[model samples]
Target: MPLLFLNEKSWGTACDPARAERAMADFVDAVRAAAAADGPGTALVSEVDVKALEIAEGYPVNKWIGVSPRHRVLWQRLRGLQGRSPVRSVFPTENAADHLEYRHDGEVVLGLGAAHFMDGIAVSLPVARQWQADSVALERGELVEDDDGTLDMRHDTVVVRHLSAEPHLDGHLEWIRKTRSEGVTTGPRIWDSRADLYPHLTFLPRVEGQLGSLNPHWVLSVRRALERLEEAVAAWDPATMAEPEWRTKVSPEGETRKRVCRFTDLDGETRTFDLHARFTPGAGRIHFRLVPEEHTIRLAHIGGKIRPDL
Candidate 1:
């Protein structure tokens, strides 16, 4: 959960722990119902949600996608969160929305800036790429938007990352209840996949916008991207998911601006990944296909792959 966890502190008194828990439960129940519903609100976004849920047991579908953020509105309905800080804010001398971030037993383990939890997991992102606002800083006046202005990150700025996967609600609630429970306090623009579809820098929204408008076509393209991502995940051996780290290396080759990376799997199998950038969406931003798949780091990047090896 990077952002979109409304900080309960922002809600002042309305941010009750028990109430928040109740709200979380309610939100999840609503989502499950909504997932089953076929009318209205079931647009492009719903398509993504329902499809992922449908495939929950089929593949790597139930790892929690982007549902956490959607349920934020649900909690607001249950408990009218307070927004106006009794004190002055860094940017808005006045606070606006009243939302509970998230908590477990009592303490604020993690406050969802704009997220809701169902089952034991939370969603991280939307592979479909709607250019929505993802987050905004709580203490700091940092605005983290998506490629498009569809989301209002100004308010969805509370969240946590790197949480240990909790098998059940009891564990998750404990994590949220403890202020110091596997905590990763952060500011805006941070990228820690403890939760989310991918590792997105807080500035991803801004960066994506510079590329171009995010329309259905772009979203559909993102669907393609997800397909690629899923393919990678599927092809990835579970051993790679656990221990035996895998690595990829990319390098530029002459005029081709080539990139070469290799996947070093747990089985000691190395799959050479090489790509030549033939296009870029914005200026020098390279946007091209890959020999194996459209996922490459850079002409010469030894760090994380330009795209996840999967």
Candidate 2:
């Protein structure tokens, strides 16, 4: 299931206490409705965010919750979630390093940071510009304005904004509904079909072309392998990533290891892409290169497995 983190930065004072309470009620309702349509997902929260929820706009939000018996019960359930933790508790262990460092303003943004680290969605109120935008940008470890007055990142973290607005709520529901129907659409980015695979996979341009011509029969197998690879890449340290044996035959090229295992990248530099996985016996193969220092995978080829004897 998807993991949604509460955007702590979205909490702030408002001029109209009633309006603020209404907005909070709407946001909570939207979350519950989405969960009902899809299966319930883990909602990550921090002590800071929960306390902020208790008091915002010069009024206690819990009082608003008490006004509605339904809301009071729903709020209690959300408060009992196991994801509630102290600030910065979401950080991974010291050994498993990654390139995507979480950053915000000078102050800590615990929820967004945790969402990014965990490859989950950051659920925010329509308050700050960073949370308001469909996408957000970061520069030199800080959230910065974008060229088009928006925010973005390639292979970016997903941020669902403005739960109270119908348009934005519709967008969030689209994701949830799709996730329920199609399994891969759960994370920050939606991978509803083969067309939606590129952004999440991040394959090299030439390798992408190879995917187009692949046999139709092996397509599902390939998708499964890539999905597993995506999960592994997110969870494991790159240096030791190959330790696990994958069901889809993730391993180095065997007989042709010396010959076709090396390929030139877009930069015209010869690089070894020995890591490979088979779609099936003698059917199709996916060979890729891993950049450990950057924690990235550059898919070099996706075609028939090379065989020296053949």
Candidate 3:
């Protein structure tokens, strides 16, 4: 027998578990109306109340419903439903937050927390049939962008030659690897100068004075030097540090030459690092150091000449 449901407007037939589903559906509709009205004093759905109802109804929470993160209640509910689902690929958001967009094939199955669900309402069905359609298109080799705006194509698989035990450290390294692979010449520079003092060790200038005065070839040199530094760090081994062959040290010895830097690691331990130089024709030189304990490399400085003070 179909269950009868009574709301403020009308009565309707809600069969068995569909009663809960229908109630949720109505809640979504109310949220949508409130958002669209854009009027003062509009009441939005309470996440706590929605969660309680979902728990009471025993509904699957993490289903991939084509909604954006702006629909907080609906988005979180879908996340809960699809939390355990297998994902084929993961993509980072533009803001570089820890939360990532998880995709199955070319369709987004999860990670919509950074998206705008209400924006897709005009084209998307109330129940997320559009996402199913996208999945089919993906299977057909069609390209699409996921809800969080990440390209849905299968990225070239990167087999990490060296893996870090620390998840956060590994994530930071992966970000650098991906940035290098994509040939991203401009973006936020890693500010670890306080960790070690080689001077301002960055490829791109963060200040107004650095905008145009930088030499083009020098920029390329710094970039390539950084890439090589990343590769070397990826393959570094602490156990073999005693071997001279394993340690590739460059020249220019004196008070003006390379120096050791000491900094505290994420674990709150002080570690010492030795600087090495990589020269680029017409672009001067770049100084960097490998910290084996942290499983990462740090760019120390870039300059026309080595400063004795440093």
lDDT of each: 0.27, 0.54, 0.31
Q: Please give each candidate's TM-score.
A: 0.20, 0.47, 0.28
Q: In model 1, which regions exceed 4 Å deviation?
A: 1-113, 116-171, 174-180, 185-235, 238-255, 259-310
Q: Write the per-residue lDDT of candidate 3 for residues 40-96, one digit (tens) a residue.
A: 322221212222233212343333132335445665533332111111111122223
Query: Which one wins on lDDT?
Result: 2
Report the C-alpha lDDT of model 1 over 97-147, residue by residue, as the tens digit.
Answer: 122233333344323322332111232222112111232222312222222
- Better model by TM-score: candidate 2 vs candidate 3: 2
Better of 2 and 3 by lDDT: 2
- lDDT string, candidate 2, 1-310, tens digits: 4456676666764546665665566566655554454565555555464644643565666676767787687677656544656534543332221323454555555566655444445666554445544444432232322222343332333332334233444666665665456554222222235445543245656665565566543444466567676666556575666543343446665554647677777678987788876543133567787666656566777767555552
